[model samples]
Target: MQYLVLAVLVGCVALLLAVLALRFGWRLRWLLGWLKGNVLLALLAAAVMLGLAAWDLQNFTEIEPRAATVGTLSFNKVGNQQYEAVLTGPQGNETVRIAGDLWELEVEVLRWHGLPGALGLVDGYRLHRLLGRYLALEQQHDSSANGRELLPNLHSTPPWRDLWAWIDNIEAHRLLEADAFEVRFIPLTDGAQFSLELGPTGLTPVPLNPAATAAMKRFN
Candidate 1:
């Protein structure tokens, strides 16, 4: 929706520029001739802008920033050096096998662009990285290493890099420590933010709110 609005806006601006150029006739003759000679370049530029606008509208989702939840972290110690971290909601039960003793949830900031962003219509964040830490393994490799920062040489996918470039936006990554037998997430505008801690008896949702469940849905 936002992208659709943006495409329309760009088109309108282009139309306005044409009108102005035409209205100024003699005053803008050189500009008009130049435009005619460089028609292909003009069209190419317009096409690129429209394509980006469409892509943005399709990829980006708008949500209530203050109430939005970004991502969740849940894990259970399965063995001496192994743990299972549940991703997203409980229904999926999608788990990742980790050889680490801890986990980190990283978030990337995303904000609206053009007119919508200027008017504050769209602004939020998105999940960039979610990684499990193997503290024991790291200690074995680097004796001086402390788990204050993320493991080095972390690389992102080409599509993700391209999308970031297309949007020309800067992403902020924040690390949150995850505890064993519990799930917690930060309150981000675009991703999942929920807290669920496993107790002695079993697992249960924290805060007991419908939004908690809905947050997982939005985050996914």
Candidate 2:
């Protein structure tokens, strides 16, 4: 991942250098000669970057952040006022899924990737809409616009929403922690079949979006 990110950065710099070289059409020859003076250093940098890129590519292929599949989730009514959800792991998995109660349920993701969606996956915003109930994703950040932090959902910035969005995003991640209603995207095996908290602090669960789960309970 780091190599992927660095390659992207260097690629941009390389592109700019190419543009500038074109702009100095007459000095191109002299610039080429000057570049030769640093050929060894330039070659070393290139080798290092290429090596990093290769390592990053290898890791990307081997690592999967979250196995979105290979697991099943179900919620059931233990009684009239009480609900019980069971999260079980597959043959070779550790993560589990258990929704104690939707009212106190919370789902949060760091919201990386505004990666253009392919396959069945939708872009960040559309995914937000479709899974709104189960997930509560805050708008992404934009540093290039208006010299202020703002919501990534919109193209333009409104100071008020921007400020709220920034503050809320920070608070959301900080306030939620372990023992705050067992978090498992897939199945978690061993230790704490469930996490129980007696205090009010660990009481709330921030489903990535609350709207997506309205139908979850209906499944039972």
Candidate 3:
């Protein structure tokens, strides 16, 4: 809290000083000296900060807590700490999502096409929502409980598989936070260049690009 306050205070002071310098035209000498002396260092510092921020964001994207599921996919420890898929579906809804590595899952292509049945192909996944960026998925290893080793598993299957592929190939904005962020939709890659909010559950899609809504249909 103190650090946040300090940052805010520093920004305000900088702004105030800048305004004063411009208004008075007297701080010109000091400003020039400061710029000449510190400009490169300031830029370097900014670059470092941005780099650290990016690294932190990457870490956040790589890992997520357990007990969380993406859509209907629940992650569980199948065997030997490997991941397993658990499909939970009711009558109308038929869906399959990968477990364990939710945040690691990336969005391939988020088509505005509403899921054909109970499953609607969304622009992003629960994993993408949590991380704030999508793509570069790492397949999870699956091992049988009885000491049998199993091969790696796909992140998602069925209707979501194709969309996941799309997000992988595109770059997009990750919502800062669901409840507080405002999303603008740009459907260049169907969902490649856009920002989206997953809302509270992270499953309830919010602010879907309305322009593409025409392509969307309810499950039939």
User: Whose TM-score is greatest here?
Assistant: 1
Clashing pairs in 1: 69-191, 69-192, 69-193, 70-191, 70-192, 70-193, 71-192, 100-134
Least accurate stretch of 10 residues (summed lDDT) in model 3?
185-194
TM-score each candidate.
0.41, 0.21, 0.21
Candidate 3 lDDT tens digits, 119-147: 63223222322111112222222222322
Question: Candidate 2 has what TM-score?
Answer: 0.21
Q: Evaluate model 2: give its lDDT.
A: 0.32
Error of 1 at 180 (Å): 25
51-73 per-residue lDDT for model 2 (tens digits):
65344222111112332332233
Provide the overall lDDT of each model, using Cα atoms, as 2-decimal numbers: 0.45, 0.32, 0.34
Candidate 1 per-residue lDDT, tens place, 98-160, comes to 444334554333444556566666543333344444445555355236543333211132443
Each prediction's RMSD over C-alphas, in Å, is 16.5, 19.5, 19.1
Off by over 4 Å in 1: 1-42, 45-53, 63-65, 70-72, 78-80, 89-95, 113-115, 136-157, 165-220
Best prediction by lDDT: 1
**C-alpha lDDT of residue 115 in model 2:** 30
Error of 2 at 4 (Å): 51
lDDT of 3 at 111: 28
- Regions more than 4 Å wrong, model 2: 1-34, 62-220
Pick out the ten consecutive residues of candidate 1 with the lowest summed lDDT: 173-182
